[model samples]
Target chain A: MNPTAIRLSPLDNVAVCCRPIEAGERILVEERELVIDVAVPIGHKVAFVDLKKGDKVRKYGMPIGSVTVDAPAGSWVHLHNMKSDYLPAHMRDAAGDQA
Target chain B: MMSGWLRSDGRKGIRNAIVVVYLVECAHHVARRIVDAAADPRVQLIGFPGCYPNDYALGMMKALTTHPNVGGVVLLSLGCESFNREALAANAQQNDRPVETVVIQEAGGTRKAIEAGIAAVARVRNLVDEQAVRVPLNISELVIGTICGGSDGTSGITGNPAVGRAFDTLIDAGAICIFEETGEMIGCEGHMAERAATPQIAEALVASVHKAERYYRAMGYGSFSPGNAEGGLTSQEEKSAGAYAKSGSRPIDGVILPAERAPGPGLYLLDVVPPGDPKFGFPNIVDNAEIGELIACGAHINLFVTGRGSVVGSAISPVVKICANPETFRRMEGDMDIDAGRILEGRATLDEVGKEIVALIEAVAQGQATRSEELGHQEFVLTYKSSAPSGPSCMPNAA
Candidate 1:
């Protein structure tokens, strides 16, 4: 089977999509079957385990940010659910709106 | 064996370039006109736009004018700006480089200054041709720098790690490898500290990253940008982990600030963020600004890894572009030097690409032009900033 995603570390709670993953597609991660709930673009992250708000989102064996909202396994994890612990991520529209 | 121009300071350079430098923004047009009129690919334009005198800018100018790659310099001044042209010219002359100065006020006007600058460039070029001595260069004598820009998720797994492997190969060959942008290294401090060769250097490494965090906080922005977010990086630390992979697995020899050369041949971290309170607006406005700092530190060539595909190249030193995303590589193949994305596509391994990068570096060192140079990309930028001198503990291995 072709690899669909890459998990950087064994301790990571999320895996990076190697190619665009379609919604409602069933994929096996570490032999566990997961039904992706939403389309995740390539390079985006997908939760490997269920997460609660305030939980640390782990990647590369470290906490990248805190989950802002509860997300289930196989769900897309991004700015909407996770935010940086250091500084807020800026988007092009948000920057232009401030300007 | 590769041959290079040997400078009086016992440094070897792969390229013998004559630079036209404008001391202030007012003299920029005339300096650019001079370079354009000369029509020589070896002649390039660089300048400081600040009308106010800045110690950092002055020191960078002095370092760049006497850099190993530079054989001659032409200083352009507007006569009213605060930049000290005389001191810069004297520094270049002291290094045995052909130097000339043209003050716009003294030379009458813009047209006249351009005329004088063109003639000065010609004279400097002639002097450089006569003075430059060809000498055999060894791979161990080279200084290489690495930086990541326009990064995304694929960078860490592909191009960044490949560059890291290449850095390891270069360091083993006794070449000096420098990795920079402490602001982008936020989440990897612990890993870096553990890799430090000395206890003092470990402390210095952690301190530099913390300083960059505080500096970015005060400026209301981390190095994290809109493009980074759009490219699928959710946070600064996430991006940093990918950026950190470019340093390879070597024990870090030291930590040095911008314009400070590494004391010996090993991996060194460059702290691009200035010290003290956030007086300057940003640590680095663009990728080119960081490239300037690397050049000032005597980097002969820089490896630039990009997942979102940045095409920028520096003025003084050559930038080897590494594309991390296979899709991006297919789109912008002409601008990239290596397709590290093949690792992700299962067409090649990281070790294979790493060896390819090392081979490319050897070819470039032997006087081959990079894609950027062939396309006439000589982008340069410098801005105001302040930094106190580093302590001896920063380089414990240095005598």
Candidate 2:
């Protein structure tokens, strides 16, 4: 079976979705099964473990950012839930409007 | 074995290009008209738009004019600009490259300047072609640079790591490899420091990343763009982790500032952010500015990794585009050279793609035109910036 998500590092709390995964679909990351809580697009991250607010999200065995809200295992992890520790990430609308 | 154009400076270039340079923005049109009139793929145009003199700009121009890939230079001056055309011309001439200067005001303005510039380019091109030397080139003799633009999550797992693997193979073969954008390498400092060749070099690496952080923090931007977020990257460090994968897992020999050539064949980090307080805007306004800095550092070719997709190619050195997103590759197949997204699709392994990238590099060095090159994408950019010379610890191994 083709993998829907890949865990880049053993220490990572997130796995990157290799293909578009719909909500409620059950996916296996290594030996553990995860029920997709939300639709995750290709190249986006999915939480492999339960994350609490202010907990650092690890990918590539490094802390990418911290969770802003509580996200259970298999939920989509992105800008809405996490933010850069150094600088805020800009979206298309914020381009050129940075102070 | 591949053959290269041998330069008087003992460097071998995969290409022999005649460059037309405009000293100021006013002379840009005339210089462009000259390049357009030449109608030769080997002829390229590069310039600085500032009317005021900048030491960094002058140094960059000097390095580019005498670059191994460049065979001759035709400088366009608006006559009264503070660019110091005489010094630039003399520098190129000293390197045994044919050099010519067309002063717009002295030549009586637009139409006349274009006419004079066209003549100068033709003369320079002819001299360069006649004096060109063909020599045997080994993979060891080549200098390669890597940069990722329009990057996303797939970049780290696919294209970037594939390039990293290619870099490892190249470095082992004695080729010089450079990975840049210290701004994009924010969170990877601790990991990078551990891979430094010496304790001093590791400290320099950490200091360089800290400087980039301070500089970006002061500027209120972290080189994180909107498209990056749209492509599934959540933060700057996330993007940085992906970007850092292009360096490959090798002991970094040293750090070199922009326009400084690597001391020897090993992995080196190109610190592009300007030193001191952020005075002149962004360190690199666009991707091409970084490409220009890479070329100035003696890179014969650059491997550009992208997930959201970038179609830019440089003026002097050829840029090979590696697409990390299979979806982007399907949509912009014509713009891409390597489909590294195959790793994501599970259609190919990273090692397979890594070998393919090395093979493609050899083919490109042997005169194969990259997709961007065939499309005539000779984008060039240079802006005002200040950088202090790197300290001794930055290159402890350098003689």
Candidate 3:
């Protein structure tokens, strides 16, 4: 058996799915038992709790990006939801023009 | 922890490598034949492709020949290539290492050059092995390089930051650390400059990044890359932050480690983008180009952090692979040395990974082969370009 999954930072609200998670799999997270739905590829992220729209996804206690859409516990948290906190290209150019 | 092989100039090398560099694209085949004939892992192939006279390429080549990691060098020339082969050979010889040149035309042909190169590599390898003097090395004497590849979402949060933590530890210990790829460094210039040792250096640092931005902008690709977007990075700045974490919060010491010139100590930024304009071409076409740049600046080892799973190192130095994605580590454990990804799954902390990297560095310094080293991933590449000399304030005004 592949022992327990490894959690990154204390602030990380997600555990990297070390092993591929198949649908309906019951994975242990701290004390919670979150069942998986779709197959999460290895090295991808899985939520530790039910996250809502606009909820900031905290990994390493820093805001990596915000969860774009709602995500249920054990659901996958990836590009479909997470977005960067840094400014986009247009804003960056605007900021550049100010100087 | 243990004794390391001593080089003549008071520097130490973990492994004594005889580098066989192709002076031009035409000579690459002959050089490879030579390395293959020698069949020794310690003998590696490196080269530039363009037949143009590029100051950047020439300077970098000279720097790499005298890198602390190299014990000897052999230059292969097609004789007519614009590269300055005689100067390269002279530089290697000046380093007190045995150096020789094999001009394909002068040496008769490919078959002759191959035989000659093989003999040269074998001879150089034997001499280098005997030149090993046991010397005491400290963490402070270590020159380390950091690079990130195959990055994904977890890279910034786990792997990259873990490297940053390790960089912090190494820098605090007085080790010389380097991080590069300004194209990858696009958006975070201001923040990165803020971390420099001095405000003056910060401004120069910002200018250096702007140089890269201009170069890449001319090339029509954000240094961010398509793979980065596939991995959840939206813009260049976001990717830069994750990549920047490998510095571990150390005060930036200087910018663009001059080819062949070692920094006094502390963290450095290898300004890889052309110093002036993007005249040559792709700013470091592949990851190995960056690795080559670090070697030119005297890196004895590289702390390579990967989240999307990269199975790579370098020829002259051992690459300590830190896997940031727990899942990626699980998928590619054999290729990684440290699993900073454990932080994401709540199995390990950043401190643990940092310590592991240090121990790995000491072990590698004592001749323990890294995963990439054992796999024999000795890749090298150099191309053409030019750069105006960095203005003062690029680094702290030298005391």
- TM-scores of the candidates in the order shown: 0.98, 0.98, 0.83
**Candidate that scores best on lDDT:** 2
What does candidate 1's lDDT look like per residue over B260-336, in tens digits?
A: 98888999999998889988689889999999999999999999999999998878788999999888999999999
Fnat for candidate 1 (0 to 1): 0.63
lDDT of 1: 0.91
TM-score of chain B of each: 0.99, 0.99, 0.95
Lowest summed lDDT window (length 10), candidate 3 chain B: B225-234
Q: How far is candidate 1 from the true structure (C-alpha RMSD, Å)?
A: 1.3
Q: lDDT score of model 2?
A: 0.93
- Lowest lDDT sum, 10 consecutive residues, model 2 chain A, at A90-99
> What DockQ results do all the predictions give, each relative to the true complex?
0.73, 0.78, 0.14
Give the per-residue lDDT of model 2 (tens digit) for B1-399: 899999888999899999999999999999999999999989999999999899999999999999988999999999889998999999999999999999999999999999999889889989998999999999999999999999988888899999999999999999999999999999999999999999999999999999999999998888888888877899999999999999998899999988898989999999999889989999999999999999999999999999999999999999999999999999999999999999999899999999999999999999999999999999999999996888999995744
Instruction: Write the residue-wise lDDT of candidate 2 on A1-99 in tens digits.
Output: 668899999999999988889989999999889999887778999889999999999999999999999999988899989989997787866765654
Model 3 iRMSD vs. native: 6.3
Q: TM-score for the first chain of model 3?
A: 0.77
TM-score winner between 2 and 3, please give it.
2
lDDT score for residue A15 of model 2: 96
Ranked by TM-score, top first:
2, 1, 3
